[model samples]
Target: MKYEADSPEAYIDLLPEDRQEPIRRLRKCILSNLPEGFEETMSYGMIGYVVPHSKYPAGYHCNPELPLPFLNIASQKNFIAFYHSGIYADPELKAWFVEAYRERVPTKLDMGKSCIRFKKPEHIPYELLGALCRKISVSDWIQLYEEKISR
Candidate 1:
C-alpha cells in the first residue's frame, strides 16, 4: 500500500485504526519535545517535520519543495518508523539508543538501519526516548547530520 498523508497532522488521521495509537504516541513525543522552529509537512509519502523552514536555506534534498529526512508513521504496516535526520545523530546517541532498546527490544519489532520499528506503543520507553530528544541540542543535531552525510 502507498503511504500517503495530505498534511503532517492529517497523516496521522489517515492511518489504519490499529496503527493510530502508537503513531499518536510517537507524534506527541516528537512534537512536545522537539525544538521549536521545526516545520511539519508531508514528504516522501510520509509525515515529516524539519527544523527551520522547509524550503528557505534548504535542507539535504534534491528538490527544495519536498522536505528531506521524512519521518514516517505508516498505517498500512503496523509499526512506527523514524526517518533520517532524527536517526543516526551521534554514535554515542545511537549506541545509547541501541543499548537501551536491547534491554527491552520487543520480539514483534522489525527495523531498518536507523529506524526502530515497533508494533506496540507500550514497547517504547517514553521516558528514555523523550529524554534522548531533550538531551540533544541544535548544534549537536547539526553535527549529527555532518557525521552522517560526510561519509
Candidate 2:
C-alpha cells in the first residue's frame, strides 16, 4: 500500500483495522528492544527508526539531508516488511538472524537482503527480531553504514 503520512502515528492510523493490532505489537517489540539514540519517524512511507540529523549530520548515503535509517516497518499489499539496516550492512548479523530465525520459526523465512517479509505481522518471530534490534546501537550502525558505503 502506498502511504503518505507525516508521522509514524499517522502511518499506523492509516492502516486497516485488521493490520493495526499486529503492526502495533510489532512496533512495541521493535521499540522495546531498540538501543539508545534511535528516533522514530516516517520515512519512505513507513514507520522508520533513524539516527536523527542532530546525531549524524551526514544522514543517509543516498540522501544526505535525511536522517540515517536504522529500521523500517511497513504493511504492504501481500505482506508486512521489517527492514533492518544493521543486518543488511553486517554479514555476521544477517547470518545470526537467519540461523536464529530458522531455529525458532517453523515456517519459511521470506526475506531479502534487509527486509523480512511476512504475510501477517503475527507470523514474525518477535523474540529474534527484538534480539537483533538490541544488537545494534545508533553509533554502531553509523560506523557500519559508513564502512559499507565508503567501500
Q: For this target, which candidate reaches the highest lDDT against the unseen true structure?
A: 2
Please write out the lDDT profile of model 2 over residues 99-129, one tens digit for every residue: 9999999889999989999996667888888
For residues 9-75, write the lDDT of model 1, one tens digit per residue.
6777777776677777877877787665556666667666654443335555465554334344444
List runs of model 2 lying over 4 Å from the truth.
Answer: none
Candidate 2, after superposition: displacement of residue 50 in Å?
0.5
Q: In order, what lDDT does every prediction score?
A: 0.60, 0.89
Tell me each candidate's RMSD, in Å, in order.
3.1, 1.1
Pairs of colliding residues, candidate 1: none
Candidate 2 has which clashing residue pairs, if any?
A: none
TM-score of each: 0.75, 0.95
Backbone clashes, each candidate = 0, 0
